[model samples]
Target: MESPRVEMISNSFVKPKFISKEAKKPVYLSPWDLAMMSTHYIQKGLLYALPKNQDFSITAFLDDLKDSLSATLTHFHPLAARLSTVKQQNPPSFSVFIDPNNSPGARFIHSSVNLTVADILTPTDVPLVVQSFFDHHKAISHEGHELSLLSVQVTELVDGIFIGCSVNHMVADGSSFWHFFNSWSEVFRSNTISRPPVIKRWVPPGSDPIITLPFTREDQFIERPSPSCLRVRNFHFSSDSLVKLKAKANSECNTTKISTLQSLTALVWRCMTRARRLLPDQETSCRMAADNRKRLSPPLPETYFGTSLHSVKATATTGQLLDQSVGWAAWRLHQAVVNHDDKVIREFVNSWLKRPFVYTMSRYFDASCVHIGGSPRFDMYGNKFRLGKGLAVLSGYANKFDGKVTVYPGREGGGSIDLEICMLSKNMEAFESDMEFMSVVNEEDNKLRIF
Candidate 1:
């Protein structure tokens, strides 16, 4: 299939409308923050269907969005800051901090595409469709000197507009990114801001001094993953199919009731492993990102704008995953989540403080591992953007790294899920034809017509 053509209209830098007096001061990065410094930027986007008869100037819309984004940064100051290290004489160690003065502000681009909303609504090459709407180079750039932690691109189409946002993973996680996004949209809609984030960094209890790991300057920036022939595809399961999956998963284990996420993760892990046809004794694992906000003692603030995530892994031999029932695999996944209590969260923090630079679960990037991203409960569809016509669809984009799967709420508004699966091209072909996989999924739900 031929790729759609997109024409760039303008590229410019957007600074904060109002800079805080404390903007020059440094903000410390927690242990959790350090872990994500080398990860790829988190990219999110939305398609808004404009009223057919309602004529509006695209230039006006772009100006309003840029102004509103600048206003939003006044509250999210760290996002408008550059990452740097602080050398302390007393400890003889350097700590990472966000330097506001050095930040040049977020990148903003205006572009136009010939593709209409209808062209992208179906199950086409999603990554290719969404890639043109985003600033792909800046999204994955590892050059720290750029100092632009956030970038936004507004692509105008004949029938609608696509708002694509990219944020440095080191500065924020999914929760934090959405928090900023919602706030910006609120500003754009009502000309007022919502709840400002709790900027105070959450530190682990106890007076033990922070051990600064020895990391070179290059380690501070993320190294782009090696290129590969990976393809990304989208699959949707209806609410009814999810219910049947849950029932099947629950019947395997009398003690635990598996949630939709666990069941789906188990199913996908099994299918991917089968499609890859790993050796019988090869070790396979599924890694998931768990939110530690409510699980922690006293709980972090709901608006804490930083990385409050922990990586949880469930491992089983390839043979076990392939031979076992979906329910059994789900039980294993459930156990992994249940074990990540307050103690585990604390232990993870402690471990990171000791050896802050070493990547956690780096082995999971191998072919035998599947990394689960996004959550069913994130309310992704709720982002209305106050555009009057409502949001047509919401999507996420990431580097097409193998073994990566992202889950989002189905557009049908029922208790369903949309899986964005990425793997080697050959593996994707095999996965598409897997009968067990096809039987569980609602094939009719594959095509989505948002209009």
Candidate 2:
């Protein structure tokens, strides 16, 4: 398929209406944020269809959006700040401190695309289709210049508008990211902000040497090698199929019932491992991000922002993963989830204090790995920016580097799920034809239920 044609109309920065009084003071990055400093920026995009007879003016629409963004930034002022390091200390330390004198505003781009809404909605190559809507480069260099923690691109099409946003991972996780987006949408639609985020940084009590010192290290920023032949394909599973899978998983063991996530993840892991054609004893694993907001003692507020997440991995030999039933893999995943409690969170903090450096999970990004991200709980479909019902499509631009798997609520809503899987182009071809992998998918031709 040919790349979608896009033309940049304008580029500008949107500053806050008025910097908050508290933003004048410098705030340190939390331990969680420090740990995630080396990762790539998080990006999300949404495509909204415009009514056929709707009167549209690009200039007026952009003006309204910029105005609302400025108002929204008053509450989320930190996003307008830049990352700076303290040079007075023995080793320079980095923090997201605002210099009231010169704050780097968020980047906003207005562009025009030749494609229509139907072109995006129709079935096509997942990676190319999604990447065409993204305005900025995938990677961000945080070392040299002032960092704009948040950037937005609004692309206008004949039948729709594509809104793309990029946020530095150090500023927020999935939950926090959505909180900002929802708040912006609320402000744009109703001229009012939602619940303001809790900006207080949470630090464990103790003056231990490790706890006080910064975790930044030059080696921690080493970039991972990008896969040479990566490709993305999307698969959908209906709510009924998930229920059947959960029931089948539960039938394997009487000790505990497996959840839909666990069953689905296990199925994906098995399929990916088989498609890769790894050795029998090759190590294979599935890694998922677990939210630690409620798991912490003195649970973080619902509005608390920043990265309050931890990774959990379920592992087995490729032979075992392939030879075992889906129930067996689900049980393993279920156990991994059970293991991440309050104690585990505390232990993770303590461990980070000791090591104090950012690093990728080597096993989780390996060829045999299947990394799961995003969650069914997020309200992806409800993000209406005063426009009509907007459909959110899973973008593959961010996860195209490795064996990444992103999960989102299906377009039909209800409890159904859509999984966007990324892998080597050759393996994807084999995976698409795998009978076991195809069994659970909701296909257009096969209408009969397998169970």
Candidate 3:
């Protein structure tokens, strides 16, 4: 062991410096983080529930998770590690910095996690512990930054377990989150870091000149709301069954416009419509997140660790929505993809310079106004790679959040999609029927798992 005299000398003379060569500088978040920024209260408290298998263990799971996150954390360059501070909360919020260390860019934030659900074996009260964790995390703030991204909570319930992660809105986006999760898992499975996450020059070229303003100059920063109610639900599916559903949707639409994702979106939209009994004339928006990394001139690297694309808001009337078959809805959904549109791209750029957070338009579609969520993602690559679950959440300002569903191909010549819907207890039945229909359509052809 080192002597206390030497330790004191080292402490007096040596200042710890962040080894960014091996680690990333903290990335800060800006008010203009996402393409479709929801108002604060509209998109904050999201929960996802996943069914637990008897074999899953909380201790082993957390150990693996910590190992994976800690390993991948080293890949970020100093600039990427820059954290952001926004002073609009009870405790100022902390965001992952989004601007390139050397260049001007919009600040975006999205975070990720790997969680497991195991049966509660001990008689201890888990919710109490969970509440404590929440309070502790909530109170923990990043030093000098207005946003904090390190809040994590774990709770053991009588039936299963829960993991809660609070992410600032200005650091990364959904696609970035996916890339991060995959990288974390890759390192965990291999027991070593994989290739560094790709972060090519993502900003498109030749924009009209505009002055760079501090975040305070922006019009709409997401305002934090008073504490509110939050809920979670979990679901799963096999890989093969989803393809069949997509095929059926394609046939019904009589066009190749239907993708597995679009078909599932149609199913989700229909169920949400039926459950809410929304009128056809009522304006409803199902904002589908489109990744724009490849749409730029110098396509952003898939592993680039910041918000890259603007969210495309697809608005449809309840009547027009209900009148369409799964195929038609899928086509409408496809037409909504506008990553290549120059006008939209310009707006995205301008959003960063203007106020009221350009992405805040999504607030108009909050739970009270429109349904502002989308279906899960399930691709063949997700399965062969064992990328854990492809769950997504749509939350920001409010106490409520939406779930993520993924489609996978099954071994028995079918495709399946797993859905985890979290809403009020009153809406549980509607959610079940939606899942049931999706399962029936896909499972009829093969095996399906709904967890």
TM-score of each: 0.91, 0.91, 0.62
lDDT-better candidate, 2 vs 3: 2
Cα lDDT tens digits, model 1, 1-451, are: 7766888889988888887777667777677776665566788778878655566767777888988888988899887777776566654556566778756788898998888777777645564667777774534423333647787888887788888887877678888887888788888888787689887677787734333645555644345566378787778888888888888899888754699889989999999999998998999999888888888998998899888888799999998888889999999999999999998898878776776663423433777888898876665666665554434444445544788888777776778788888889888888988888888777765754446
lDDT string, candidate 2, 29-107, tens digits: 6667776655667778778876554576667888999999999888877777776655435565543333444765888
Off by over 4 Å in 3: 1-18, 21-70, 77-148, 151-167, 189-191, 199-201, 204-220, 225-232, 235-241, 338-343, 351-362, 368-399, 402-415, 431-451
Sort the candidates on lDDT, descending order: 1, 2, 3
Name the best candidate (by lDDT). Answer: 1
- Which is superior by TM-score, 1 or 3? 1
Q: Name the lDDT value of residue 117 in candidate 1.
A: 79
Q: How far is candidate 1 from the true structure (C-alpha RMSD, Å)?
A: 2.7
Angstrom error at residue 150, model 3: 3.7
Clashes within 3 Å, all models in order:
0, 0, 70
**Model 2: residues >4 Å from true position, as ranges?**
88-101, 127-129, 141-145, 207-220, 361-364, 445-451
Better of 2 and 3 by TM-score: 2
